[model samples]
Target: MDLNLKDKKALIFGSTGGIGRSIAEALIKEGASVYINGRTIEKCKAIAQEIGAAGFYAGDLTQKGIAANITGQMITDHKGIDILVTNTGGPKKGSFLEVDLEQWESDFQSLWLSVVESLQKALPAMSAQKFGRVLLITSLAAKEPLPGLTTSNGLRAGLAGLVRSISNEYAKDGITLNLILPGYTNTDRLKALNLSEEKVKEMIPAGRLGEPEELADLATFLASPKAGYITGQSIAIDGGVLKGH
Candidate 1:
């Protein structure tokens, strides 16, 4: 299946590791000119070199407005990006009582606003060109709340509203925007959670944690020219873990 991505330029955030890195690898494999992002220049460049990415950008999106600036630079330097995939790091973990107002605000700035700012900068150029693909990599927590993840549960779900509303505005311009909500994937982040695989597998009907490549393949297809008709939608790549309609 040709994704029709031979020369599309893609900028991926949080590409140093985990699911982000998997998506980056998939894009490059499909012949996209990929640029990766990380917080540190040395790590970003090293990953770019190892992965054969076209370049790297350094920015900590937790800080306010940094994503906007990064996208602005991409537009200025490369005349706008054809595909943008932004994956924000998980927010501070806490239960409802454990999280305070300050924590909520912090999550808003880090998880929510960062992606918004990046899209703000890139969407215009895409509209002008009449072509673009935007993929937001969130978590299954966005749909089904997990224990001790109050921030992720609340803020990530908010992104669904953002995608639905904003995607409608740009659909006529040939740009597709969607959310990729992942469940327990086999990544260092999941390993760090120290979850009992036996228990988690009991919950997921698929009987195991997902692989990064599985999620990445879906992302690659969505970002392709062939997926232009799919937009304003939030698709869960969870192993039948999400039961909502």
Candidate 2:
């Protein structure tokens, strides 16, 4: 249970709220120094204060310069990051034919390409130290392809493929790259969708949506030394909602 994570540094994207913040809190609880990232400085600072002296990075990762800026700042402050949690907001809900080319490109940049940049920035240090945990917080839509989330479905699936390929390339370097697919978590975004809690619970086999902490716990474990053998996997934390193995 120690997780052996003390003193390790983590850079978690989209940490202003929801699952990303949950992951940051869990990492801090495990004694890891975490850099919480968000687009605005105020939100980042606020969350960092609430989470206890967390390092904060404010940037829009969808913009090319912002990723480098964040990585640069972190390196200057803490030398390098050991764990990278690549998480972001999902694309707008719409059918495949409804989404335009710009929407597709933007979604790819926000949800998938940002991970590529973050890894490129953080990998050298992790490889040099022979210690790294790269966990991409994806969605069950990557596999199940929900009707209203066609953009998310396509982009997240591509993200899964990217993670799979990199897991193979980096396993020998002591870097474990894996994807965590979550289903129906209770978050502000989900709440805003306006479905009754009971109605949502009925759809999932577990009879309830997953909690942010539940997904956070899985991410923490995957980022730990104990999960060294779990690379190249698309592990679903969907409470049996995902049917297939």
Candidate 3:
């Protein structure tokens, strides 16, 4: 399980905390050159230092042009990244009727459009090198819609479709695009929902919430050379919560 990830350059967005930070730590342990990204410079730099990342990128992906700007800066600094993990914070939780048009537009921009922009910026370098691993951190809502996550259910599912289409087009170029669906992971986002661990565990067959590192392990593998043949797949790490075929 060498992963053959040594010296590979990786860019992970939303790495200041939670699942993103866990993924960054895993990549660093696998000997990849990791870049920690967050909205604030100080936070990103602190996490980068803590995780021994190669560098850090600061920007808000929700804002216009930010994804392209971050990718451009990475290209200028490291030439280009071999792996790109597009991880973003989830939108506010609410029923479909509770969400407004503005919220939908905002969520679409941050969760969907920004990802497209980042890929557009990073793909050329990946194509030129004939190597790339794109791992998107979506959620179980993408597969089985959650009760209170209307926005995520819609946008993340859309992203899944986009990943499949792009993966087919890029597989010939030595690039693999895939989605990682994390279910009830023990992260800040989960904590913010004020969900009782006992209550949540009761719903999962595993009888426990997933650890961030659990998702990180899979992400590390997906972003490595070993996973070259895997593409356009939405793999869930939801502890049997998603009982769909």
Best by lDDT: 3
Candidate 1 lDDT, 1-245, residue by residue in tens: 98999979899999989999999999999999998998899999899999989888899987898999988898888877899998956776788999999888878877898998999899999999999999999899888898888989988889999999999899999999999999999998887777899999999999988999999999999999999999988899888998854
TM-score of each: 0.97, 0.95, 0.98
Candidate 2 lDDT tens digits, 1-245: 78988988898988889999999999999999999988899989988999974678888866765666676578668987788888877668778788899888887788877877777788887888888999888899889987688878877888877877888888998899999998999888787666788877888989988999999999999999999999988989887888855
Model 1, 129: alpha-carbon shift in Å? 0.3
**Candidate 1 weakest ten by summed lDDT:** 86-95
Candidate 2, which ten residues in sequence have the lowest lDDT sum?
64-73
> Residue 8 of model 2: what lDDT?
87
Local error of candidate 1 at 77, Å?
Answer: 1.1
Model 3 CA deviation exceeding 4 Å by range: none
Q: Which residue runs of candidate 2 sit more than 4 Å off their true CA positions?
A: none
- Model 3 has an lDDT value of 0.91
Compared with the true structure, all predictions reach lDDT values of 0.90, 0.84, 0.91
- Each prediction's number of clashing residue pairs: 0, 0, 0
